[model samples]
Target: MNDKMKLKQFFPMLAFASLALAGCGGSVSKTGIELSNLDQKAKPGDNFYQYACGGWIKAHPLTGEYSTYGNFEVLIENNNKQLRDLIEAMAKGQHEAGTLEQKIGDLYNIAMDSVKQNKEGYAPIQADLEAIAAIQDRKEIIAQMAKLGSKGLPGYFGFYIDADIKNSSMNLLQIGQGGLSLGEKEYYLDNDSATVHVRESFKAYMEKMFTLCGSTPEEAKRKMEAVMGIETRIAVPSYSAVQQRDPEANYHKMTYEELKKDYSGIDWDVFFSTMGIQGLKEVSVGQPEPIHEVEKILAETPVEDQKAFMEWKLINSSAPYLSDELRACSFDFYGRVMSGKQQDRPRWKKAVATVEGVLGEGLGEKYVEKYFPAAAKERMVKLVKNLQDALAERIKVQDWMSDETKKVALDKLASFYVKVGYPDKWRDYSGLEIKDDSYWANIVRSNEFDLAYVIDKKLNKPVDRDEWYMTPQTVNAYYNPTTNEICFPAGILQPPFFDMEADDAYNYGAIGVVIGHEMTHGFDDQGRQFDKNGNLTDWWAPGDAERFEARAKVMEDFFSNIEVLPGLKGNGALTLGENLADHGGLMVSYTAFQNAMKEKPLQTEDGFTPEQRFFLAYANLWAGNIRDEEIRVRTKSDPHSLGRWRVDGALPHIDAWYEAFGITEKDSMFVPKEKRVTIW
Candidate 1:
């Protein structure tokens, strides 16, 4: 499974300014969910998103370095400042060898050591460059790819250790279609104005990298074309990002002997041996159709062209860690052209991000000790339970689902494993050696160490159900179908999403809904295919499954029909799972809110009823100012809908939302009862 559902497109940072609360104590609304951010001119029924978030959007415009900015960014910016203080303090303090602090601090110090990095320049990566240049035959190329893959530079395809979908108890080798430089197959295939322009820029980018690698001008041009040609061929075989969403379509188990017989361009024995992977009798190919094409591409392409392609891949992946010129060239295409960011993020921020990536859990242990309190975790537990109960109630009463399916659904819900704040066991970093000598070396070494641990140690072993894909410092949550678990990181347990002292109404609408969102992921269009044991077996009755699919199709069509830009429409089929979670979460959270108020009534404050406040809180969290370029990219790539559509798209489907906002048939966002899609 993938990591947690990311709310924002951009990476999170520290809050720029402390949110102005109404009171001196934590009881104050630090989340900024008041009506001040609303645009009174807009009718709530006609355009609820504009009504709820127009003022905030007007106040905050996109910054030079940010593609999108919103509540998540604000929280991250605040978090980054806290982390920056901790990092800076640790960097200055003395620590023992192999300590988390020492490793963290040394990594930070090396990254900031521009002089050392500049003096060494590309000299640090000379050995890797030489290895790629020395490639002569297919065997050497295959071995080199393995070497690079182990070092975190993926050369040909992707491989990872995941719990076998059919048997969740075992960790198995998963080989999937990868090796493309662009984000998706569409980038290479689509002939839209934007796609064509990006393709041309990417070709130029490859040429620039080849030239920088000391290739003659003509040689660079020819090599770049060859690399692009190879990539395009590979792209032709790969599934679109949307098609990859279907788990059943992708899952294919095979013995090693069977796989070799099916596609025999590269010797599996030699390749696996080179990768240092042993004792593997079988593997699950996520997409065998694309992999079969790899055999054809290898046979048709010359060894020289393949070498050029591999060389480009090596240089392209390592460019960011190299000298200023290479890094700048890399950023020019990926950062500026892709995301429309005119400048680089602050060096300290970048350094902090790098440290977090390598030593996240280690740093996360420190983050929780300093930030997350016992009370917050305790409160979250109750909130999660409330949402679970609400969802269970909805499932029992679902008119379309039969009693047989309901029983299985409840069983799955009962089996749900919830992890809050941090993992029960922390990952040991004592085995990963980090030094202050070289930044690039530390990164490469860390990648190798991680690969070895996963390939040599974790693979072929029993699955660790308690293991988390995200760090405690990550501002996100996830539902893993394979583990039948939902995780809430400490990073998301703050203002906007959750505030310890906020009234129950706001809490239910914000963090409570988020909790439900993740919980609903278990039964989302894709997630529901996996049973309680996290096995890919159908537990639903045939008729009930068909009914659910029919209802799901309505929501899919609704999202697909939405025009994000001229000639650009949202891919409903691609984002179906997320949309399902959104709709289901909203319904269940609203139920949980009603259940909460039955215990004790809350008074209306600032002229908003508790119900209205709940809806407002939910909408305000999605207040975002995004760049047009980012909009174009995310429309084609991201599975989650945009902030505007997250509100406008999902809200129209909820009957309670229309009643709370006094919506009518005349309203632009109005959806009649028959047209509204509700799977839950």
Candidate 2:
């Protein structure tokens, strides 16, 4: 969906840190840092990330299956094994029809049946393709786009229902620019060699897909050109990723009548009726320029060309579920070309991921019951409280903010909605049916089932603040500004993030920083716009807002200068929010760790002082290897800095880090106090 509310997470998708100290060829301990994991040969003053994580990096090199491999993947692999056992057990048992077990079991069995999938080939989507070919007029074409979009295909534009940005209580219909096969507009428009290579690869993949669907070579070439032309025209006016970050800039709410009159290329009444939405009075057009461009393309394009574009959308979206050949073709461009993943993941992994995606909360309910410990939740509550108290203290003492703003900041801090482990209530999958059918057909039905919920229950309803956006099995944490909440799912509760046996320093540096990072997101450039109640209203004093930006600007310029690759540099403005969260997380969590030590003092363990272990533990959370292609892709799309930079680029600005390592101005990584950012 185009207008999903932003949930600022610690990492991009599948992004998380691990602090498990086991399996590093060191003495096994229930607590403390992993001494063998550190590259003692490297100097901390010059490269702390390398010094702390070098040994781990050398031990765990990137494999063909991953573009990047680190502590997060280690945790993911462990979780997947547990999930596989659970799902496979269900698949092997006999359950009553319409039961949750039956649905999940049948879905997994069908996905794993490669013989059936290969036999079906593209037969499942042939009907949809025929419908596109049968279209005779503009209205028919628009109607077809709506039909495909309902099944999660990219149409000329994207539409969804979400909490209104300005009014956070009620759900509103939102539209934004989409339809580009290459997600980033830069890939289509950039003149760089890397971009051009990817562009060509995407084009080749498109032609191959057309040919696989029984098109002649000549016909496939013509269709590929038609689809590319349509998509390129749409990409021309689409918002850049950075531009889309500004909530106020992206949001343009208009009356239903105004929308129909201004963008009259499509029939609004028909579109809404087709989408099963009624009584729609207002809509938010996020990035209207691209929608206007799409409108022009739709109205002017030839009927045959439009049909080819629609067919391509269906083919591209359905390839993963269709056949092995189609799946490999899809992965060749997206996986091998874009991310440089040398090999495809195992089929069981793909099937497991599909089951999780469609019925996540269902799987999560069982996952929490089996894998998540009750004691972990109890401890997390206390850790969260300690971090909250620390943040409140920092806000109260901030010299850059006035008393008027300080009061509000502390109020926001106190009002934080903390969710640990899992949600109090889980989603019901009673209406979903899993039958013996084609995998692609089942996928479409699952998507429709989800869309029905959004249309039937969520539209025109009050936002459910208690609902969890992520599953219990997800190895991640997030801060949703609209809900003013911080969530730590069950998957991230285990080591090296939260070790019940580890001392305060290890836990504080790992999960403690994560908890504080989500808390600090409330005051980041975007999150700061939302008030205590989660409405997008500016509550800062005049001078305080200016001072916050001025301080943040230093962070922007600091990261912008660091070269992640030979010619590529970090996007300071794009990563400003995450950078601020990282900086603030360290400050708040360190204060909490110190407070923790005051009550129960800790002695040095594993030949490192408590302070040294704290930083080392934090660095270990980011230890792993990454491919250069992934580096380029992430630089263009990901908001979080590279893992190495998360440690290296971030620690330089942290004053406590200097004290922990005894670094002075003479150190290569030292920054003058005048230039360092002090914003929390």
Candidate 3:
């Protein structure tokens, strides 16, 4: 692949499992499968995704507020309702000062106070805007960028503290390319008609925002051009999403002195002081080329042009918290133009979402207490263990991997730490101050508080393994390579993903596969680079590593050829790890499900065999209706394949699935025996 086209998608915090399900379950039939979701006319051998999801897709269409709707959205809607109740109840009640509920309630009140918000239009961020306008020199511009960076706003670049890839025991500061109003570099550079249209829309959006900031049309045009020039320059040095996947390649450790000397334009001392860091040592530069590009831009770009870009960045970052007009302008571009949503989500939903983002763990504490049960956690524990056992057995008998590599893989499996339902310790939010006077101010403070918290936790402190990346209320699961752990939040441990009431087949196919998927990640392309302790290491023998890469290459070619939309092909290399996990998860979970069946025999239920029901449950979890625009975007950006491909692409590789459904070479879904790609 061309280096320019090899840009890897960066997950700033942690990587989540690729194969996950959505939502609470609906009415169960005798067969456990929601028969209403099945299209009886479609043959399983020809197109399993359609066979399994056709009816469900027909029943559910994309609403104005959504670009895509599926099991995940249904679950989110249910969870959002629950969150809404909690927020509303808190807003309605009286609580003491400095309490979690008080903060929640107060923020809710401020957000919903449209009259007050309209009266104080743009006042909350007036100080920040004025500060940006005051920047006349290069030093001031650098200082302001650092100030904005601390408040979680992108300036010339972005930074975060993550477990050091090499050490896996200490945290290090990682910096990369940023400052794009458009989310991705491809939006600024791609010559496709859709991409060109997006660039134009972004320019129009910037003009509207500049006008709202009290600029004349001429001034707005100049500012927009300056901003685009700087962003395009920054985008020039950005690595493709594919390049970011190789963690070892991205990790470049350097001292503060070396960095300042090497990239000489910016005053490192002023920037660090503004960020409240007294001393700095080593920092990991993620994409060094981008940083060099930034240095070059800083040296060559005029102070006025730099200020123009900075001003736009500040306004754009604060737009959501500004007046309704500004917020609507933002929505019109990012929402309608980008994702194809025709309308804004309800005000209450937006408010609830803001609160969740700011104080997720606090909200999650309440969520798990009321919703997640002890029995569900207990069941999940057993399910995970079964999957682990199945994977261990498979590793022991692998023909390609040497005995030495197998032993290490088994050790890594044994060392896996599992977190279910919720975290053992909830984050302390007492330091965060929330006031009802201004919603935007409270959000800025929240961002500052979060920034300080992250710095305090990582700078001189040991790595906190107990720290959870996601809140309990998030309906997602992840495997943290650095921590060597898999986390299943309480929000995801619900009916459709995992349910105590559901049959063994359903649970195994849903959450069971999820568990296996996470576990399989430890041995996937990127995860395999890390040892049991989560440090990036080559644990595999030389021959074994080459063989694994060869197999992975097969997967890359297979998915790259798949056309997701007209003239849009899936980026196989970009999605290789995820596709591998899906395949591995299904294989391991099927084995685990069979083992469970042996313990408690399964019979044909509701006219479907046990194996058939299991496969159907897997397919049903991903059934969704999505817009063409969204499909086109995901085909380029999303790491996971589309839901339809997740089913149709993965099932044919599984021997048991074919046997259970009586599929053969004559079927459309069949692949020649020699062509199937299977890597665990």
Which residue pairs of candidate 1 clash?
A: 13-76, 13-77, 14-76, 14-77, 14-78, 14-79, 14-80, 15-77, 15-78
**Cα TM-score of candidate 2:** 0.96
lDDT of 2 by residue, 21-76 (tens): 11111224745577778999998989999899999999998899999989877877
**TM-score for all predictions?**
0.95, 0.96, 0.97
lDDT of each: 0.80, 0.84, 0.81
Q: Rank all candidate structures by their TM-score, best first, as comma-separated numbers.
A: 3, 2, 1
Worst 10 residues of 1 by lDDT: 1-10
lDDT of 3 by residue, 1-680 (tens): 01111112343223443322223555475445788888989999999998989999999988999988888888878888888888899999999999999989888877787787777877777788788888877667788988876776777777677788788888877666666667567888899998999899999999888888888999999999999999998887777667777788888889888888877777888887898776778877788887888888788898888888877877787777767888889899888988898998888987888888788889888888787779878888888899999999878877889999999999999999899878899999999999876877787788889878878888755689998877888888988898899888887887677766678888788888788888888998888988898898899987999988898888888889888878888899888888888888898999999998898878888778899988998998799988887877776667788888888888887888989999998899898878888565
Write down the lDDT that model 3 would get.
Answer: 0.81
Worst ten in a row by lDDT for model 3: 1-10
Model 1 residue runs over 4 Å out of place are: 1-32
CA-only RMSD, every prediction: 4.1, 2.8, 3.0
